[model samples]
Target: MDKFIDLHVHSTASDGTCTPAELVKLAHKTGLLAIALTDHDSVDGIEEALMAADRFQLELIPGTEFSTEYHGKEIHVVGLYIDYKNKALTDQLRQFRDFRDHRNEKMVLRLQEEGFSITYNDLLKTFPDCVLTRAHIARYLSDTKQVSSISEVFDKYIGDGCRCYVDRPKVTPMDAVSLIHQAGGTAFLAHPCLYKMNRRELTAMLDELAGAGLDGIEAVYSCNQGSDEKDFKALAEHYHMIISGGSDFHGTNKPYIKLGTGKGNLKIPYRILENIKTYHQKEK
Candidate 1:
């Protein structure tokens, strides 16, 4: 069997439903040789994941997914093989968590103003000990039958440009790239297709990020079509950036995306991890 690796995943330390230990067990059961816990704006799960990796003899890369913005669109940047103990990185992530907490509170207030009977306290009760994300809010709305589906909640509220949407503070793309470098990691644009940018626009953005120290682009992703993967691979080649991929697994928070195989057809080779490490070594 071909060894596989999932470079983007999440655990309960963030919005994902699985704990770090549980995720590790799942990875082992799923036959993943390596997996990175690239939780949103937090490395709190890294130590626990590291312990689990050691126990299972699985490769675990310490990573984080940063929330960034450009042209008012939310862009995500993933930092792979980061030094999770780096003080500057940890301090900034702590600030991000604080901002997320405040943003969640604001969203709750906005929902209440829109005549929804929800509160930040209710969210905490619903998703105890995990980051209060829009996904959590959507789940609450769906579970209560206030929304027919999770997508419906985003369409009617909470999503960007929706009535109850409260934008979270974001770092610039350049700043996000720099933070990854400061943490001794490779920065890659996460899921370029999700930006909803056309070909020329996305290329322009990638050119800017490439100049800002971006090392790769996510050419293979759970949500990407085959044509999108081909286009992204071409873009990566055009910019001389490494190609990277991931399942972007968030456990039950994103039920369709599996750990190693996303949507049942995704297969990211272990060589992608080796390629990244090879580049990191050369950068040193």
Candidate 2:
């Protein structure tokens, strides 16, 4: 009954449970008008997702979530409607994968040092043919009885400031925006409220990013509170940035919120898609 567009979802190519094709089918069944596979640091799902889109008549946006550093914090930049075949984009993502692999290895070593016996090979077995992520590591911990739940893994080891946390290489926000632009996409700030910054800090960060050619912001997201969503929508309007929203689905890796749930309160206006369409047309 609801016509929606879920712009920030993952598949097996990243940390989600479904394959690209299966996820597309699910979206069609759920009445999503369009869907973007904004997998973290990878566009591996784009090709299959596009094919599935053709089958289901769903609009597909090639997307990836890149990690960027700003003011000592990690922020995510989601590039939408990208040319996945762009050599520059592919090359940069490959480099990011390499960095991620290195970080995963370091995380395993850190966990080992903390007396957890998980190995990289053991972790790889969990998601063959998919990008490895912290979610995968957390799942491994939970599955093997190393931890009781994924949240435990995060609280004890993988979360920010945890004992086994390892920093990965990140691009500056400016460079990330530039890369997304070069790849023929618009860079949007993903899940701004997750940064947990106060009003002054969040506004300052948004202003800084908007000045750096950031084209949009996630005005609605799963984790945002009512006030937070209203504030972000106002910010988007004031700054003339396109509004973006998503379910932030990660399969069973997240238990409470399912795909397209949007924390049960978020609704993205169809006008956002019209805005994106208009912007693309003008670029042509």
Candidate 3:
């Protein structure tokens, strides 16, 4: 492909180390045609990204990764080409931030009770741009030497069902898709393989999401196995959905993953996005 785009990326607005401006500069220097700032549960960075994208002459897709749930398991729904200023989407994101803040407070308290020195305010100050995720908290813990690494923090405390883990109020995947569509964005399932569900379970979730007007799936990802792209593409074809791809870049958080080219070998052609626009236009 002559050009490439990374449809999923994070900024310090949510769990990533790079600021929005820095991410845009890096994408430009790395020779990417475009990148989507799909920060976790937040679009606070989109404005800065847009400004920098303009200066660098690169496309910046304003997006967010919505945290949703199905049968109590957390699922991420990515919204691409979003209008971050849309009141409905911003209002809902505010609500999500509030819920997550409550959950983060509870989590911090639980950790403090277990003799950790971390506090909720520390996390807020540390991750000032947007809503704080466990990834942010993990970095705090890791930086403090309470944990050797972020991975260790999750393994011992905040991974799902861990003692320090607290569940946020659940937003269904279907509801997420609706909100994305309401905001005039395309909704996609992000990194399905990471969900670790069997084919039957995955299909059922897709069916559920499709019923709510989900437009596509993240068929290509930074961590795809040798055959994963082929398998995921076939799955998307089965559901008549467009295929999206990304590096899921988290800056230093996932240091090995790169923008546009994920984990060194993942390449997402510009046409994938063209295809998305084409598919949605026909639907309209």
Candidate 3, residue 244: Cα displacement in angstroms equals 0.5
Which candidate order results from sorting by TM-score in descending order? 3, 1, 2
Q: 170, model 3: CA deviation in Å?
A: 1.8
Tens-digit lDDT string for candidate 1 (51-170):
999999999999999999998888999999899999999999989989999988988898888888888888889888776789989889888887689888889898889998888789
TM-score per prediction, in order, is: 0.96, 0.95, 0.96
Greater-TM-score candidate between 1 and 2: 1
Model 2 per-residue lDDT at 149: 90
Candidate 2 backbone clash number:
0
lDDT, candidate 2, at 222: 89
Winner of 2 and 3 under lDDT: 3
Please tell me which predicted candidate would have the highest TM-score against the true structure: 3
For model 2, how does the per-residue alpha-carbon lDDT over 187-259 read when each residue is reduced to its tens digit?
A: 8999988898888998898788888888888877889876887898888888888788888887777766666
Clashes of each: 0, 0, 0
After superposition of all CA atoms, the RMSD between model 3 and the true structure is: 1.3
In terms of lDDT, the poorest run of 10 residues in model 1 is: 124-133
Give the Cα-based TM-score of candidate 1 against the true structure: 0.96
Model 2 earns a TM-score of 0.95
On lDDT, the candidate that comes out on top is 1
